[model samples]
Target: MAQTKQTRGACAFCGRQMTGNGMVKHLSACPKRKDTLGESNPKSGKEEKIYHLKIQDAWLNDFWLHLEIRSSATLKDLDSYLRSIWLECCGHLSQFSTKGHLGEEIAMDSEVSALFHPGLELTHIYDFGDSSETLIKVVGEREGTPLNEHPIYLMARNELPEVETCACGKPGAWLCMDCTESEDEVALLCEKHAKDEQHQDHNLMPIINSPRTGRCGYAGPADPPY
Candidate 1:
Protein backbone atom coordinates (compact mmCIF):
# COMPACT_ATOMS: atom_id res chain seq x y z
CA MET A 1 0.00 0.00 0.00
CA ALA A 2 1.09 3.54 -0.65
CA GLN A 3 1.46 6.12 2.11
CA THR A 4 -0.80 9.12 2.08
CA LYS A 5 0.77 12.54 2.49
CA GLN A 6 -0.56 14.59 5.35
CA THR A 7 -2.22 17.94 4.82
CA ARG A 8 -0.49 21.13 5.94
CA GLY A 9 -1.38 22.66 9.28
CA ALA A 10 -0.11 25.69 11.18
CA CYS A 11 0.83 25.36 14.82
CA ALA A 12 -1.41 27.46 17.01
CA PHE A 13 1.43 28.75 19.17
CA CYS A 14 4.46 29.32 16.94
CA GLY A 15 2.79 29.63 13.53
CA ARG A 16 5.14 27.01 12.10
CA GLN A 17 3.46 25.05 9.30
CA MET A 18 3.85 21.28 8.91
CA THR A 19 1.87 18.15 8.22
CA GLY A 20 -1.26 17.65 10.32
CA ASN A 21 0.27 14.75 12.25
CA GLY A 22 3.54 16.68 12.55
CA MET A 23 1.63 19.58 14.03
CA VAL A 24 0.18 17.23 16.64
CA LYS A 25 3.65 16.16 17.75
CA HIS A 26 4.92 19.73 17.44
CA LEU A 27 2.14 21.03 19.67
CA SER A 28 2.85 18.37 22.27
CA ALA A 29 6.36 19.70 22.93
CA CYS A 30 6.35 23.26 21.59
CA PRO A 31 8.83 25.04 23.87
CA LYS A 32 6.66 28.11 24.13
CA ARG A 33 3.83 25.91 25.41
CA LYS A 34 5.79 23.55 27.68
CA ASP A 35 4.43 25.23 30.78
CA THR A 36 0.92 24.14 29.85
CA LEU A 37 1.87 20.57 28.95
CA GLY A 38 0.66 19.15 32.23
CA GLU A 39 -2.83 20.45 31.58
CA SER A 40 -2.97 18.80 28.16
CA ASN A 41 -1.76 15.38 29.20
CA PRO A 42 -4.36 12.73 28.43
CA LYS A 43 -3.47 10.66 31.49
CA SER A 44 -4.32 13.52 33.82
CA GLY A 45 -7.86 13.97 32.49
CA LYS A 46 -9.37 10.52 32.25
CA GLU A 47 -12.84 11.78 33.07
CA GLU A 48 -12.97 14.90 30.95
CA LYS A 49 -14.98 14.57 27.76
CA ILE A 50 -13.84 15.68 24.32
CA TYR A 51 -15.82 15.83 21.13
CA HIS A 52 -14.42 14.01 18.09
CA LEU A 53 -15.76 15.69 15.01
CA LYS A 54 -15.65 14.48 11.40
CA ILE A 55 -16.21 17.36 9.04
CA GLN A 56 -16.40 17.51 5.26
CA ASP A 57 -17.90 19.32 2.33
CA ALA A 58 -21.52 18.28 1.97
CA TRP A 59 -21.09 17.29 -1.65
CA LEU A 60 -17.45 16.25 -1.97
CA ASN A 61 -15.89 13.31 -0.21
CA ASP A 62 -12.34 14.18 -1.18
CA PHE A 63 -12.03 17.09 1.25
CA TRP A 64 -12.53 16.14 4.87
CA LEU A 65 -10.95 16.37 8.29
CA HIS A 66 -11.01 14.76 11.70
CA LEU A 67 -10.92 17.25 14.54
CA GLU A 68 -10.99 17.02 18.31
CA ILE A 69 -12.47 19.86 20.34
CA ARG A 70 -13.40 20.48 23.92
CA SER A 71 -17.05 20.16 24.76
CA SER A 72 -16.90 23.63 26.27
CA ALA A 73 -16.04 25.18 22.93
CA THR A 74 -18.76 27.31 21.39
CA LEU A 75 -20.03 26.84 17.84
CA LYS A 76 -18.48 30.22 17.06
CA ASP A 77 -15.06 28.83 17.88
CA LEU A 78 -15.67 25.87 15.58
CA ASP A 79 -16.90 28.29 12.94
CA SER A 80 -13.73 30.31 13.18
CA TYR A 81 -11.59 27.22 12.98
CA LEU A 82 -13.44 25.96 9.90
CA ARG A 83 -13.05 29.32 8.20
CA SER A 84 -9.36 29.38 8.89
CA ILE A 85 -8.83 25.88 7.53
CA TRP A 86 -11.29 25.60 4.65
CA LEU A 87 -14.16 28.04 4.16
CA GLU A 88 -13.22 31.66 4.70
CA CYS A 89 -13.08 33.24 1.26
CA CYS A 90 -14.72 36.55 2.16
CA GLY A 91 -16.19 38.17 5.24
CA HIS A 92 -19.43 36.34 4.66
CA LEU A 93 -21.79 35.31 7.45
CA SER A 94 -21.96 31.60 8.37
CA GLN A 95 -24.16 29.48 10.59
CA PHE A 96 -24.68 25.92 11.88
CA SER A 97 -28.01 24.21 12.34
CA THR A 98 -29.90 20.94 11.97
CA LYS A 99 -31.11 22.11 8.59
CA GLY A 100 -28.96 20.72 5.79
CA HIS A 101 -29.74 23.19 3.00
CA LEU A 102 -30.76 26.33 4.86
CA GLY A 103 -33.40 26.11 7.54
CA GLU A 104 -33.90 27.14 11.21
CA GLU A 105 -30.61 28.59 12.36
CA ILE A 106 -28.86 27.87 15.59
CA ALA A 107 -27.03 30.65 17.32
CA MET A 108 -23.28 30.75 16.85
CA ASP A 109 -22.82 31.03 20.59
CA SER A 110 -24.20 27.55 21.28
CA GLU A 111 -21.86 25.26 23.13
CA VAL A 112 -20.71 21.96 21.62
CA SER A 113 -21.94 20.05 24.65
CA ALA A 114 -25.41 21.50 24.26
CA LEU A 115 -25.82 20.75 20.57
CA PHE A 116 -23.57 17.72 19.78
CA HIS A 117 -23.38 14.11 20.84
CA PRO A 118 -21.86 10.85 19.74
CA GLY A 119 -24.08 10.40 16.69
CA LEU A 120 -25.66 13.74 15.87
CA GLU A 121 -24.91 15.62 12.67
CA LEU A 122 -25.24 19.24 11.65
CA THR A 123 -24.81 21.38 8.59
CA HIS A 124 -22.82 24.58 8.30
CA ILE A 125 -23.43 27.19 5.61
CA TYR A 126 -20.96 29.87 4.60
CA ASP A 127 -21.84 32.74 2.24
CA PHE A 128 -25.46 32.63 1.17
CA GLY A 129 -24.76 33.77 -2.36
CA ASP A 130 -21.86 31.46 -3.17
CA SER A 131 -22.43 29.21 -0.23
CA SER A 132 -20.48 26.12 0.80
CA GLU A 133 -22.14 23.65 3.12
CA THR A 134 -20.24 21.35 5.45
CA LEU A 135 -21.59 18.24 7.11
CA ILE A 136 -20.33 17.84 10.65
CA LYS A 137 -20.76 14.71 12.71
CA VAL A 138 -19.91 13.98 16.31
CA VAL A 139 -18.30 10.65 15.54
CA GLY A 140 -17.45 9.74 19.11
CA GLU A 141 -16.23 11.08 22.44
CA ARG A 142 -13.40 10.07 24.67
CA GLU A 143 -11.03 11.37 27.30
CA GLY A 144 -7.89 12.55 25.53
CA THR A 145 -5.16 15.11 25.46
CA PRO A 146 -6.48 18.58 24.72
CA LEU A 147 -5.01 21.33 22.62
CA ASN A 148 -2.88 23.85 24.48
CA GLU A 149 -4.60 27.18 23.78
CA HIS A 150 -6.32 26.39 20.52
CA PRO A 151 -10.00 25.52 20.76
CA ILE A 152 -9.73 23.08 17.85
CA TYR A 153 -7.06 20.51 16.99
CA LEU A 154 -6.73 18.79 13.67
CA MET A 155 -6.16 15.06 13.90
CA ALA A 156 -6.20 14.14 10.22
CA ARG A 157 -7.27 15.25 6.75
CA ASN A 158 -7.41 13.81 3.25
CA GLU A 159 -4.43 14.12 0.97
CA LEU A 160 -4.58 16.23 -2.17
CA PRO A 161 -6.66 14.63 -4.91
CA GLU A 162 -4.97 13.73 -8.18
CA VAL A 163 -5.83 16.17 -10.99
CA GLU A 164 -5.84 15.76 -14.75
CA THR A 165 -2.82 16.67 -16.80
CA CYS A 166 -2.41 19.06 -19.70
CA ALA A 167 -2.06 17.80 -23.28
CA CYS A 168 1.69 18.25 -22.88
CA GLY A 169 1.72 15.73 -19.97
CA LYS A 170 2.30 18.14 -17.07
CA PRO A 171 -0.03 18.21 -14.06
CA GLY A 172 -3.00 20.53 -14.45
CA ALA A 173 -3.12 23.33 -11.90
CA TRP A 174 -5.18 25.97 -13.71
CA LEU A 175 -8.75 25.63 -14.92
CA CYS A 176 -9.85 27.78 -17.83
CA MET A 177 -13.36 28.86 -16.84
CA ASP A 178 -14.36 30.15 -20.25
CA CYS A 179 -13.36 26.91 -21.98
CA THR A 180 -15.14 24.85 -19.35
CA GLU A 181 -18.44 26.58 -20.16
CA SER A 182 -18.17 27.19 -23.90
CA GLU A 183 -16.05 24.24 -25.01
CA ASP A 184 -17.17 20.66 -24.34
CA GLU A 185 -13.67 19.52 -23.42
CA VAL A 186 -12.09 19.86 -19.97
CA ALA A 187 -10.34 23.20 -19.60
CA LEU A 188 -7.78 22.20 -16.96
CA LEU A 189 -4.19 22.97 -17.82
CA CYS A 190 -0.72 23.42 -16.44
CA GLU A 191 0.50 26.97 -15.83
CA LYS A 192 2.51 26.82 -19.05
CA HIS A 193 -0.42 25.69 -21.13
CA ALA A 194 -2.71 28.22 -19.48
CA LYS A 195 -0.63 30.95 -21.15
CA ASP A 196 -1.00 29.47 -24.63
CA GLU A 197 -2.41 31.71 -27.37
CA GLN A 198 -5.60 29.68 -27.58
CA HIS A 199 -6.38 30.44 -23.94
CA GLN A 200 -4.86 33.93 -23.77
CA ASP A 201 -8.11 35.73 -23.15
CA HIS A 202 -9.83 32.97 -21.11
CA ASN A 203 -10.35 33.46 -17.39
CA LEU A 204 -8.18 31.02 -15.45
CA MET A 205 -8.57 29.96 -11.84
CA PRO A 206 -5.87 28.40 -9.74
CA ILE A 207 -6.72 25.13 -8.06
CA ILE A 208 -6.75 25.55 -4.29
CA ASN A 209 -7.32 23.63 -1.02
CA SER A 210 -10.87 24.64 -0.32
CA PRO A 211 -14.10 22.84 -1.21
CA ARG A 212 -15.19 26.18 -2.60
CA THR A 213 -12.57 25.87 -5.32
CA GLY A 214 -13.94 26.95 -8.74
CA ARG A 215 -16.89 28.55 -7.01
CA CYS A 216 -18.07 32.13 -6.82
CA GLY A 217 -15.05 34.33 -6.10
CA TYR A 218 -13.50 31.84 -3.67
CA ALA A 219 -9.79 31.85 -4.35
CA GLY A 220 -8.61 30.62 -0.98
CA PRO A 221 -8.13 31.62 2.65
CA ALA A 222 -5.73 34.23 3.97
CA ASP A 223 -4.68 32.00 6.86
CA PRO A 224 -3.83 33.64 10.14
CA PRO A 225 -0.79 32.80 12.27
CA TYR A 226 -2.84 30.23 14.15
Candidate 2:
Protein backbone atom coordinates (compact mmCIF):
# COMPACT_ATOMS: atom_id res chain seq x y z
CA MET A 1 0.00 0.00 0.00
CA ALA A 2 1.27 3.52 -0.83
CA GLN A 3 1.88 5.85 2.13
CA THR A 4 0.14 9.19 2.26
CA LYS A 5 1.98 12.46 2.98
CA GLN A 6 1.54 14.46 6.21
CA THR A 7 0.47 17.77 4.63
CA ARG A 8 1.15 19.61 7.91
CA GLY A 9 -1.43 18.24 10.31
CA ALA A 10 -1.36 17.24 14.01
CA CYS A 11 -2.85 14.01 15.33
CA ALA A 12 -6.47 14.50 16.21
CA PHE A 13 -5.37 13.46 19.72
CA CYS A 14 -2.11 13.81 21.66
CA GLY A 15 -1.27 16.75 19.36
CA ARG A 16 1.53 14.82 17.66
CA GLN A 17 2.32 15.90 14.10
CA MET A 18 1.57 12.58 12.40
CA THR A 19 3.29 11.91 9.06
CA GLY A 20 1.03 10.63 6.31
CA ASN A 21 2.27 7.04 6.67
CA GLY A 22 2.20 7.20 10.46
CA MET A 23 -1.34 8.50 10.24
CA VAL A 24 -2.57 5.31 8.57
CA LYS A 25 -1.13 3.04 11.25
CA HIS A 26 -2.20 5.45 13.96
CA LEU A 27 -5.80 5.33 12.79
CA SER A 28 -5.70 1.53 12.96
CA ALA A 29 -5.09 1.63 16.74
CA CYS A 30 -6.74 4.92 17.57
CA PRO A 31 -9.69 4.86 20.01
CA LYS A 32 -11.31 7.93 18.51
CA ARG A 33 -11.64 6.58 14.98
CA LYS A 34 -15.29 5.91 15.56
CA ASP A 35 -16.04 9.57 16.06
CA THR A 36 -13.32 11.06 13.84
CA LEU A 37 -14.06 8.96 10.72
CA GLY A 38 -17.55 9.19 9.28
CA GLU A 39 -19.80 10.60 6.54
CA SER A 40 -20.07 14.36 5.79
CA ASN A 41 -23.73 15.21 5.02
CA PRO A 42 -25.81 15.97 8.11
CA LYS A 43 -28.21 13.01 8.64
CA SER A 44 -27.47 11.44 5.26
CA GLY A 45 -27.71 7.62 5.31
CA LYS A 46 -24.25 6.09 5.85
CA GLU A 47 -23.05 2.53 6.13
CA GLU A 48 -21.20 2.49 9.46
CA LYS A 49 -17.78 0.88 9.24
CA ILE A 50 -17.89 -2.25 11.34
CA TYR A 51 -14.81 -3.86 12.89
CA HIS A 52 -14.57 -7.41 14.16
CA LEU A 53 -12.99 -8.46 17.48
CA LYS A 54 -12.36 -12.00 18.64
CA ILE A 55 -14.16 -13.68 21.47
CA GLN A 56 -11.45 -13.55 24.13
CA ASP A 57 -12.99 -16.19 26.34
CA ALA A 58 -16.02 -18.38 26.83
CA TRP A 59 -16.76 -17.33 30.41
CA LEU A 60 -16.16 -13.58 30.14
CA ASN A 61 -19.34 -13.31 28.12
CA ASP A 62 -21.16 -12.59 31.37
CA PHE A 63 -21.15 -9.02 30.13
CA TRP A 64 -20.41 -9.34 26.42
CA LEU A 65 -22.44 -12.05 24.79
CA HIS A 66 -21.87 -11.03 21.20
CA LEU A 67 -18.35 -11.73 20.01
CA GLU A 68 -18.16 -8.63 17.85
CA ILE A 69 -19.61 -5.14 17.71
CA ARG A 70 -19.17 -1.79 15.90
CA SER A 71 -16.35 0.63 16.73
CA SER A 72 -18.82 3.52 16.67
CA ALA A 73 -20.28 1.97 19.84
CA THR A 74 -19.07 3.02 23.28
CA LEU A 75 -18.48 0.84 26.34
CA LYS A 76 -21.51 2.49 27.89
CA ASP A 77 -23.58 1.34 24.94
CA LEU A 78 -22.49 -2.20 25.65
CA ASP A 79 -23.34 -1.66 29.30
CA SER A 80 -26.85 -0.85 28.34
CA TYR A 81 -27.04 -3.75 25.89
CA LEU A 82 -26.38 -6.25 28.70
CA ARG A 83 -29.79 -6.28 30.29
CA SER A 84 -30.29 -9.97 29.40
CA ILE A 85 -27.00 -10.79 31.14
CA TRP A 86 -28.43 -9.83 34.52
CA LEU A 87 -31.66 -11.71 34.02
CA GLU A 88 -30.01 -14.99 33.06
CA CYS A 89 -27.57 -15.20 36.00
CA CYS A 90 -28.26 -15.21 39.74
CA GLY A 91 -26.57 -13.91 42.93
CA HIS A 92 -25.29 -10.38 43.64
CA LEU A 93 -24.42 -10.42 39.94
CA SER A 94 -28.14 -9.80 39.66
CA GLN A 95 -27.03 -6.16 39.53
CA PHE A 96 -24.09 -3.95 38.43
CA SER A 97 -22.58 -0.48 38.94
CA THR A 98 -19.68 1.65 37.74
CA LYS A 99 -18.61 2.80 41.22
CA GLY A 100 -17.21 -0.52 42.47
CA HIS A 101 -14.88 -3.00 40.79
CA LEU A 102 -15.80 -3.94 37.21
CA GLY A 103 -16.97 -7.40 38.28
CA GLU A 104 -19.12 -6.17 41.14
CA GLU A 105 -21.91 -4.88 38.97
CA ILE A 106 -23.56 -6.13 35.84
CA ALA A 107 -24.43 -3.86 32.91
CA MET A 108 -27.45 -2.03 34.27
CA ASP A 109 -29.06 1.39 34.37
CA SER A 110 -28.78 1.60 38.15
CA GLU A 111 -25.05 2.25 38.57
CA VAL A 112 -22.43 4.37 36.86
CA SER A 113 -19.64 1.83 37.24
CA ALA A 114 -21.81 -0.62 35.36
CA LEU A 115 -21.27 1.54 32.34
CA PHE A 116 -18.35 0.68 30.11
CA HIS A 117 -16.58 3.79 28.83
CA PRO A 118 -15.26 4.06 25.30
CA GLY A 119 -11.96 2.22 24.71
CA LEU A 120 -12.32 0.19 27.91
CA GLU A 121 -10.48 -3.10 27.64
CA LEU A 122 -12.23 -6.28 28.60
CA THR A 123 -9.83 -8.59 30.38
CA HIS A 124 -10.47 -12.26 30.89
CA ILE A 125 -11.88 -12.42 34.42
CA TYR A 126 -9.40 -13.67 37.02
CA ASP A 127 -9.06 -14.17 40.77
CA PHE A 128 -6.80 -11.94 42.80
CA GLY A 129 -6.80 -13.16 46.42
CA ASP A 130 -8.51 -10.39 48.38
CA SER A 131 -11.97 -9.51 49.62
CA SER A 132 -12.66 -9.24 45.87
CA GLU A 133 -11.16 -10.86 42.74
CA THR A 134 -12.74 -14.12 41.76
CA LEU A 135 -11.01 -16.17 39.08
CA ILE A 136 -12.82 -16.92 35.86
CA LYS A 137 -11.45 -19.87 33.92
CA VAL A 138 -11.78 -20.48 30.19
CA VAL A 139 -11.62 -24.14 29.34
CA GLY A 140 -11.10 -24.85 25.64
CA GLU A 141 -11.91 -27.77 23.44
CA ARG A 142 -9.55 -29.37 20.93
CA GLU A 143 -9.01 -27.31 17.80
CA GLY A 144 -11.87 -27.57 15.33
CA THR A 145 -14.03 -29.23 17.93
CA PRO A 146 -15.26 -26.64 20.36
CA LEU A 147 -18.08 -28.94 21.40
CA ASN A 148 -15.74 -31.78 22.36
CA GLU A 149 -13.54 -29.91 24.82
CA HIS A 150 -13.89 -27.76 27.92
CA PRO A 151 -13.01 -24.11 28.49
CA ILE A 152 -9.26 -23.46 28.41
CA TYR A 153 -8.68 -22.90 32.09
CA LEU A 154 -6.36 -19.99 32.77
CA MET A 155 -5.76 -21.25 36.31
CA ALA A 156 -4.35 -18.88 38.88
CA ARG A 157 -3.84 -16.34 36.13
CA ASN A 158 -5.31 -13.50 38.16
CA GLU A 159 -5.44 -15.34 41.52
CA LEU A 160 -4.90 -18.85 42.77
CA PRO A 161 -7.82 -20.84 41.45
CA GLU A 162 -10.10 -22.28 44.08
CA VAL A 163 -9.16 -25.95 44.08
CA GLU A 164 -10.46 -28.62 46.45
CA THR A 165 -7.68 -29.87 48.70
CA CYS A 166 -6.66 -33.52 48.77
CA ALA A 167 -5.49 -35.14 52.00
CA CYS A 168 -2.63 -37.16 50.47
CA GLY A 169 -2.61 -35.30 47.17
CA LYS A 170 -4.61 -38.31 46.12
CA PRO A 171 -8.23 -38.39 44.90
CA GLY A 172 -9.65 -38.09 48.42
CA ALA A 173 -10.69 -35.04 50.43
CA TRP A 174 -8.31 -32.62 52.12
CA LEU A 175 -9.09 -33.99 55.56
CA CYS A 176 -9.29 -37.78 55.53
CA MET A 177 -11.90 -39.64 57.53
CA ASP A 178 -9.41 -39.88 60.37
CA CYS A 179 -8.93 -36.15 60.62
CA THR A 180 -12.55 -35.10 60.48
CA GLU A 181 -14.20 -37.80 62.59
CA SER A 182 -12.85 -39.37 65.76
CA GLU A 183 -14.92 -42.53 65.21
CA ASP A 184 -14.53 -44.78 62.23
CA GLU A 185 -17.46 -45.84 60.15
CA VAL A 186 -18.58 -49.07 61.85
CA ALA A 187 -19.00 -52.30 59.85
CA LEU A 188 -19.55 -55.90 60.85
CA LEU A 189 -16.80 -58.49 60.43
CA CYS A 190 -16.70 -60.47 57.18
CA GLU A 191 -19.68 -62.79 57.46
CA LYS A 192 -17.86 -65.69 55.74
CA HIS A 193 -14.83 -65.48 58.05
CA ALA A 194 -16.84 -64.94 61.23
CA LYS A 195 -19.24 -67.86 60.47
CA ASP A 196 -16.54 -70.48 59.76
CA GLU A 197 -17.55 -73.48 61.83
CA GLN A 198 -14.03 -74.87 62.25
CA HIS A 199 -12.64 -71.54 63.42
CA GLN A 200 -12.28 -71.27 67.18
CA ASP A 201 -14.30 -68.06 67.40
CA HIS A 202 -16.38 -68.82 64.28
CA ASN A 203 -19.86 -68.73 65.79
CA LEU A 204 -20.61 -65.81 63.48
CA MET A 205 -18.37 -63.64 65.70
CA PRO A 206 -15.30 -61.58 64.86
CA ILE A 207 -12.33 -63.93 65.28
CA ILE A 208 -9.34 -61.91 66.42
CA ASN A 209 -7.14 -65.01 66.74
CA SER A 210 -7.85 -66.59 63.35
CA PRO A 211 -4.85 -66.91 61.07
CA ARG A 212 -6.78 -65.17 58.34
CA THR A 213 -8.18 -62.95 61.09
CA GLY A 214 -11.57 -62.45 59.50
CA ARG A 215 -10.05 -62.41 56.05
CA CYS A 216 -11.01 -64.92 53.33
CA GLY A 217 -11.63 -68.21 55.20
CA TYR A 218 -9.10 -71.02 55.85
CA ALA A 219 -9.36 -74.85 56.02
CA GLY A 220 -11.61 -75.92 58.89
CA PRO A 221 -13.27 -72.59 59.42
CA ALA A 222 -12.83 -71.41 55.90
CA ASP A 223 -14.97 -68.31 55.92
CA PRO A 224 -18.21 -67.90 57.72
CA PRO A 225 -21.17 -67.65 55.28
CA TYR A 226 -21.38 -64.43 53.42
Give the per-residue Cα lDDT of candidate 1 at 27.
51
Candidate 2 accuracy as TM-score: 0.21
Clashing pairs in 1: none
lDDT of 1 by residue, 126-153 (tens): 9989788999888767565675456677
Candidate 2 lDDT, tens digit per residue, 83-139? 122111121122222333454444323322332233343332222221111121112
| Model 1 TM-score on a 0 to 1 scale | 0.74
In model 1, how large is the Cα lDDT of residue 46? 39
Candidate 2 residue spans exceeding 4 A from truth: 1-45, 56-66, 82-121, 124-226
Instruction: Identify the leading candidate in terms of lDDT.
Output: 1
